[model samples]
Target: MNWRFNICFISFMFLFLLGLSNVFLGIYFCLNNIIYFLEWEIVTLNSMNIIMTLLFDWMSLIFMGFVLFISSMVILYSHNYMEGDVNLVRFILLVLMFVLSMMLLIISPNMISILLGWDGLGLISYLLVIYYQNFKSYSAGMLTVLSNRLGDVAFLLSIAWMLNYGSWNYVFFINFMGNTMESQIIAFLMIFAAMTKSAQIPFSSWLPAAMAAPTPVSALVHSSTLVTAGVYLMIRFNVLIMSTDLSKYLLLVGGMTMFMSGVGANFEYDLKKIIALSTLSQLGLMMSILSMGLPNLAFFHLLTHALFKALLFMCAGVIIHNMLDCQDIRYMGGLVHQLPLTASFFNTSNLALCGFPFLAGFYSKDLILEMCLVSNLNFVSFLFYFVSTGFTACYTARLIYYTMSGDLNMVSCSSVTDESWFMLKGMMGMLFMAVVGGSMLSWVLFPSPLMVCLPFELKTLALSVSVLGAAIGYSMAHTNYNDSLLSMHNILISFFLGSMWFMPYISTRGVYIYPMKIGTNLLKSFDQGWCEGMGGQGMYEALKNFSKTNQSYQNNFLKIYLTFFVLWIILMLLIF
Candidate 1:
């Protein structure tokens, strides 16, 4: 009867139903050779039309199962994490809404239904981010909404373009786009939209900002639903993106984003921000692989990343909750002794994240690098993958060092304890998957025939190089380099502090600067010269007198109207 109990009950029921639905659909799709199921019926003249179509293919089922699994974990974790929070009911409601929307997104066979679910997820995520209504959370929520809306605009445009060109369904678009120029354009626009939704490149700032949300929201957004949506979009349009010039562009953008965000992750101090940046970087890697026409590889990485990143974030949450909400890694060190399980889980997840040998991240990330080597864009792709791997190792190592192995002198253990059994169980389950999923995936997803015929030699060499790079990075982090001089006044530090004010000017100089300067001068003139010339406070009085003088003329339009009407009548009579 209590609010929290009610939320728990509802959440459990929803996930249970969703899991059951996925199972039924999967069985139906596989056993009955059913290509499509129409749940809603309609009529057009004498013809019967379907209103809702469900296409349950392998890809949709895989992603749907993942969504359901992760949603269930989040719900269980929230039961403990949000125990005493006043908005627990609202939080659970939003979680259910998000899960339902994601399920709908994966199952929807038409663009209209897909967009409906997509927008619903976005809206609910925004609301969840600002659930507490604090200033910072409000800003985060606004940023999330604004970024997603920009992506939604691209989606709408693409849909309209598709409709105008006579392709209203996913299957038709896939077939049509494979043989047309407009298809490439639409594909490019869709990728652009996906990038924004997944927080890739220029739009990536919003994901880090979204850390203002509760930890459960972070897990949902980063691990399972929101960020993965872009990957899904890429997968949905896999045939189109692969067969067009858009593929080349996707490869380039995705590769660059992977490398760039990897570098950014190295510079972050907040625990959540580090993980958030890593998520973006991993998304980039997945996108790059997808662009290379390897949707299966991308999906594999998506699954692995979800498992480890969720584990890492939840572990970090346990630490934060124990430390009275402190998130800065600078203030956290040597928590292993007090929170052994949290530390262990964090380490395991971080190992998987760094692409260590035989871990989930290793298989997925190595496959991505291998695909890069074999892709047509191999030269550029290899370089991006190499650089990104190095940077990923650096930041991931940094996170581990800062959190678990650092000097404990600065950290206080005033009220620290291990996480609840439920949280620990959830994390351990993910950790188990992170450790073993890679091998299972390598067997299931990688084609054995292709693996044998292709140059396994090159892939082996690539994997060796990636592993070696990670090792070098791990060793570098292990050795404490005493470079106080370098640390005291690094150029990057100076640039970062000063750039806050100067970068805007530099960036705006081309077109923005001129307009901004002109506007500023005009404002100055209005304040200093115009106001003075108009006698400051007496300007209103002068305006009032002028308005009074004009009022009679403005109001008394009867004479002018009559004269014009009479002239018009005379002219008409003369013409007749």
Candidate 2:
């Protein structure tokens, strides 16, 4: 076991080196705005050709570096979190496999190559999601895999659609797709695929369900790798997707997802699920902004969000580890007095997630809000953006208050000590990035200043939302709502909010129950009754009867043959 841990450390170091090389590659590409295209013909059969293509731009290089960096940090974090588990080695390998899948997806330029990575992501994610081998984990893994399979199918269909152009390299077709209906169809399939990966609107149930996995997995898969794959793909396809009707549809779905998840987070009590819901909400914001024709802003937020969200999950892991695996926020309080350092990391990441000024999240989130304000958006879209940002602040403030600020609620407060340095080691690795990632990405990704002139009130809108959300969140958490008249009066309303708008029910029963019932009926009727009775049972009966008749004739064959011979001789003599 000690040697296995060492092997894990070696793997992390190797990944760190890879991350550094990618960073250098990103810097070089950024400096020159160079596009390095690599292609190798793998197969040539008549007119059909299959080639492996890699596209290296600032996007892939920078994103790949971030993915590798975060993965290394997660593996380090898992050392303490997964201690004493016999399967630690396997867990580390799974994390590495997931990282490899993400890398393959990032570097691929051709649709065929992309599917390999995409399916790899889906497969590895399912394995990771069910790593615990519990009923809860199994159910979550099923939902997660089934949801992702839809995207895989969509990608395959898109690949088939792209065959009309005689190439699977989508990079070659971006500029040629504008105003073309065929491209729109392809983009439509691609958008649906992205939506599943990003967990937008109708396909969002699996994101929260995936919290059943280990916390490190939650950090890696939900925050960094799997969820963002869709956004990255959309960023690549922006030329074909932007300003189309499908983009508008994306705008609507993303907005709803963001708002719904935010409102859901406010009522959530499970520490990990709250964070999961927040990830879902932020994903919505990214999708919505991307739909508004700012893929760069979306990509920027994706990178920064990954940093803090991963850090946040690691902090949650520490608390859960010390709390004897209790995830309910109501069971935790005043952890700042007990575990000061972990709480600091936790609070810092939470604030970053809320887009605190000068931190990592602010750089991208502020720009996104400003961009949203200046864009020609409808009233509803504007409301969703501003309100959802406020909701983010509100839920985060509530989380911090419940988990870190209130009275010590644990029965054995002394037992909750942050003595695990390995956990802290991982948190420390990403702390710097969580603080400054947004600023660094903003400067490097957008070297030229964004020119925007806005009214004073418009410029301050995002600030107002943050302040208002914080104030509301604090009041809601601090005040004794049970004693207030509105508490009892709005019981039903509170139940609705707390149930996450019935998404679990709708996604599980509302969507699947009928189809599953129909499937069951079909299996019983067609497979068991008609097919088995007609093809299996009926054929067996006919064969058995034929065999019985042949045996009986053979038994009496001697006597029957003599009678037939005598009759034949008599008939021949009469004819002569």
Choose the strongest candidate by lDDT. 2
All candidates' TM-scores? 0.82, 0.92
For model 1, residues 458-549, the per-residue Cα lDDT tens digits are 75765555566566655654553333433235667744532322322333353345767988998888876687667865687889889986
Clashes of each: 0, 0
Clashing pairs in 2: none
Q: In model 1, what is the error at residue 31, expressed in angstroms?
A: 9.5
Q: How big is the positional error of residue 151 in model 2, measured in Å on the Cα after superposition?
A: 1.0
Number of the top-ranking candidate, with TM-score as the measure? 2
Candidate 2 error regions (>4 Å): 41-50, 412-414, 480-489, 542-576
Task: Give the 10-residue window scoring lowest on summed lDDT in candidate 2.
Answer: 480-489
Tens digit of per-residue lDDT, candidate 2, span 280-331: 9999999899888888889899999999999999999999998888999988
Superposed by TM-score, candidate 2 places the C-alpha of residue 536 at a distance from the truth, in angstroms, of 3.7
Query: Which 10 consecutive positions of candidate 1 have the poorest summed lDDT?
Result: 497-506
Give the Cα error of residue 324 in candidate 2, in Å: 0.6
